[model samples]
Target: MDEARDYIRAMGGGLLIGLPLLFTQEVWQHAVLLPAWKILLLLGLAAIVVIGYNAINGFRADATIGEVVVDSVEAMGIGTIVAFVALLALGRIDGGSSVRDIVGHVALESIPIAFGASLSRAQLSGAGDDEGREEDRRGGQTKSESEAGRLGPFQRLLVAAGGALLFALNVAPTEEPVFIGVGASPVMLLGVMALSLVVTLALVFFAEFGGRRHVSQGILDRPIPETIAAYVISLLVAWTLLWSFGRVDGASVVAITGMVVSLGLVASLGAAVGRLLVASGGEREDG
Candidate 1:
């Protein structure tokens, strides 16, 4: 019974995150135009991300890699079902649509939704406090507060990647990045990058956004190097997402850089939030 309720909550979260995209004309258009290979790649990438997220922040107690993988697959299934139903109800997909079109559109739409489902325990449940205490006990930590600073670099990077991908997924299919790129000068783009870095630093290091508990002491004490590394990762994620959505194809080098910069700002914010989430054992909001 509890398991069923949890799955229901996860589905609800999936709908909350995915319904808007189901109705988006741009999303539909992208589904139609994006090549099959790209769609396949996106699905595979989403599975990997879901698995990484589950391994770090999922619901199972002392979950092994195999358990995490199973949970990730289940989350993907929930996301796909939610996306398909929403698309069908909204009249965005019809019986007339080809199998490839239906599959592509649903697959792309499911990535973020699946992510939200995978994150439902953290975002929608009140059990995080209990889980944290349990973890502290298992780790032989006498102080509950000190447990937050122990996450390794690899875990932090995975969280950052998850956050970057979640944020970039929404914007990658839109024209906003390209529009901003067209209007902004090189100096303006540089300013944007600087702002992204500053915001990321503030959120992860200075902001009291419930993440201080999980923050690494090394990062909290000397944050510059880690912040720079995370910012670079965010840019790489943004660029990859843009490419996956066909946003960078045929664009000039300068234009591609601008689009990446524009998108990187948002992706960096997501990365900051992700770092905190991972640190907090995935108890924070998805952002």
Candidate 2:
């Protein structure tokens, strides 16, 4: 049951994630040209992506079905990884004491990998999803206060270490881009940021609609708290892979904040739309 759920979540994210680099231009175009339409459409898409992501991980918000969650909640971790990689590649990955850069980076750079991250989430989660969550439930481990009994000792240690590293990086990022071939350019930097926003909007709508419709009412007699589990698992995956691979030239907190907000609103709208569509579709069949 757990494995099935995990596979389903990752598969859904992969399918929903748009073609790599395809939406990057669109993100930039829409942000400047059609802010209103882009915002609305983006919100719808983001909502669906998040909703579908959560459902695939597990219909409940407190269970661990896979290594990653397609929802925005887990996407936070994915975004972290992508931003890390983006800045690393940009030769300017910074995690300075300011929360502003974190938000900026998320908005502009994170969009490109939003879908890819979602798609790759499954691979990252793998077996860890089951064993870690299972142990935490049985009182076999203790993580942070926020995590509670969600991860085992080793996993918790890993997350803590990863967070610590992020804190250190925020103080001062190393002068190295993870991807060797990637270059730095002021214009292209803005382009990347724009692209990230566009992609995030797309994700919002997709996540929202998919999550609500697929899960439908009365589907689960008692869905576990899949949300929490999925979120926690994704954190581990993000820390391990995305963070390691994330590379970018320049970082900005305002940008990431804008992207996250844009993504979240759209996701909610998409989810509502998905539910409405599913309900209508069922009604039509019945009639």
Candidate 3:
């Protein structure tokens, strides 16, 4: 059960951190333009980072050198799978694509995802509060629950907005969302909105991350409503960024809505994960 939870946390963390990059056009272009040798070198560097991270603060306590190596490989594998699926979903790579192209795309996107996976437990699983989490899993009150007051509604909204901005800031200024929006049909764009809400709910409620124990259940705090509210906040943040970046000026309503929804997918995930990390007391300032 513990191992399953760890794997889930790793995957959730990877998606939360790596999803934005999948929407990045530059990454797609790099996958196509960079040579195989360069890809291999990038993969090598990613490996080193993953291994070093696992050696210091892996999912398992007191893991040996061999265990660290195995964990690193596992992280990379998870990341590669995530990149592959996301790329396929985004229509960045299709069956007609050559094996080399697919491999290149997956490898490039997997690096940051693998980094997220490698640090998943340390960053998202409340490493500093293991005892509390264990107690939480056993249905006991958590440290955060006992010590910290639940975040109010306004605070939750603010955190969601801030997180949405952090996630969408770079993507909002780019043309990828516009390109995707213009190409997609209205139905497809609505699918994007649906997907955003689904992913956000999964990340915050169903992923079973450690911080979940601290999520408040006040007004508009139930899973479905909270998810919807966060998504709305994300869309608003997306619109603000798009407008400020001049990406939406003089655009059709359909086009603007599509862009907002495209960016909202990642923005919603950011809001959900950020609430877990920040509001639930999983995050700590580094000295």
Candidate 4:
């Protein structure tokens, strides 16, 4: 009964985060057109993310490695079922669709949904207090907390990159980035970049969004340096994703840079959220 309840909550959380993409026309298009290798790679990457998330903030506390693995698989399964059912209900998946089409579409869309499912405990359950108390009783920081503090510069870059990728993937296939780039002047673009940096800093270091905590008290936790570093990472991720989607294939350097900056705004916001999500626990005062 407990397990069933958790699954139901996870499905609900998945739907909350995944519904927009599930109905997105570009996402559906990508489902049918993305290459097999890309699809497979996405699935593998999703598994790793789900497992890593489960290890820290999963529904089950102190979950063993084997248990985290099982839960990750189960979350993916739940995400798949939810995606198929929603698509079918919306008439997006008709009976006339081929097996390959149906499978590919559901499989591709399931990755994000599954990731949301894996995050249900942290995002949906409102159980952080209990979990924090448990960690305190254990007499030291949990494994996730410990590791978050010890992350090197490269790891911080990777965290920002992953966040940018996850968020950028949602809108990259759409025309919004292109449209934004086309309409904005150079001055406007510069304003947008400044705004993105300010917002990223506020959210990650200054703002109190749900009493969330920072992972480390190191140099990266400082507003100026972390903001600069994360913004750079976001730009890199935006550039790479844009290139991969062929959005900048024949574009001029200025055009490409503008598109990357436009998308980097969104990616920076995502990086902030990602930092909060992966940081393991709530704010702690210096003792």
Q: Which candidate number has the best lDDT?
A: 1
Better structure of 1 and 3 per TM-score: 1
Candidate 1: worst-modelled 10 consecutive residues by lDDT = 141-150
Q: What ordering of candidates by TM-score runs from best to worst?
A: 1, 4, 3, 2
Error of 3 at 243 (Å): 0.3
Q: For model 3, how does the per-residue alpha-carbon lDDT over 1-287 read when each residue is reduced to its tens digit?
A: 99998888888888777887788887777677767886786577457646654654432255678888888888999999998998999999998999988998999778667867765765556555654455563555444443323455655665676567556754764678889877889899889888888878888777756446534467576778888998998998788667654568799998899888888987898788667654444322110
Roughly what TM-score does model 4 have, to 2 decimal places? 0.80
Clashes of 2: 74
| Order of the predicted models by lDDT, top scorer first | 1, 4, 3, 2
TM-score of each: 0.87, 0.28, 0.50, 0.80
lDDT of 1 by residue, 1-287 (tens): 98998899889888777766776788899898999998889888888788877776543346677778878888999999888988888877899989988998889889888988887754556345556566554455332233334556766777788898888777878899999986899999999999998988888877856545333366523567778888898999989888988888899999999999999998898899888665653323211
Candidate number of the best TM-score: 1
Among all windows of 10 consecutive residues in model 3, the one with the lowest summed lDDT is 278-287
Give the clashing pairs for model 1: 148-214
Tens-place lDDT digits, model 2, residues 1-287: 97566445544443244223223443333233333443344334443444354443332235454533335555545544555555555544354423444444434334434433443453245324534565553453222212322223233223322222222222111222222113434455455435533443343223442232223233221122222222233233222222222222143444333322222223223322222222221222222
- Displacement of residue 127 (Cα, Å) in model 1 is 6.2
- Full-model lDDT, candidate 3: 0.72
Q: Give the TM-score of candidate 3.
A: 0.50
lDDT of 1 at 175: 91
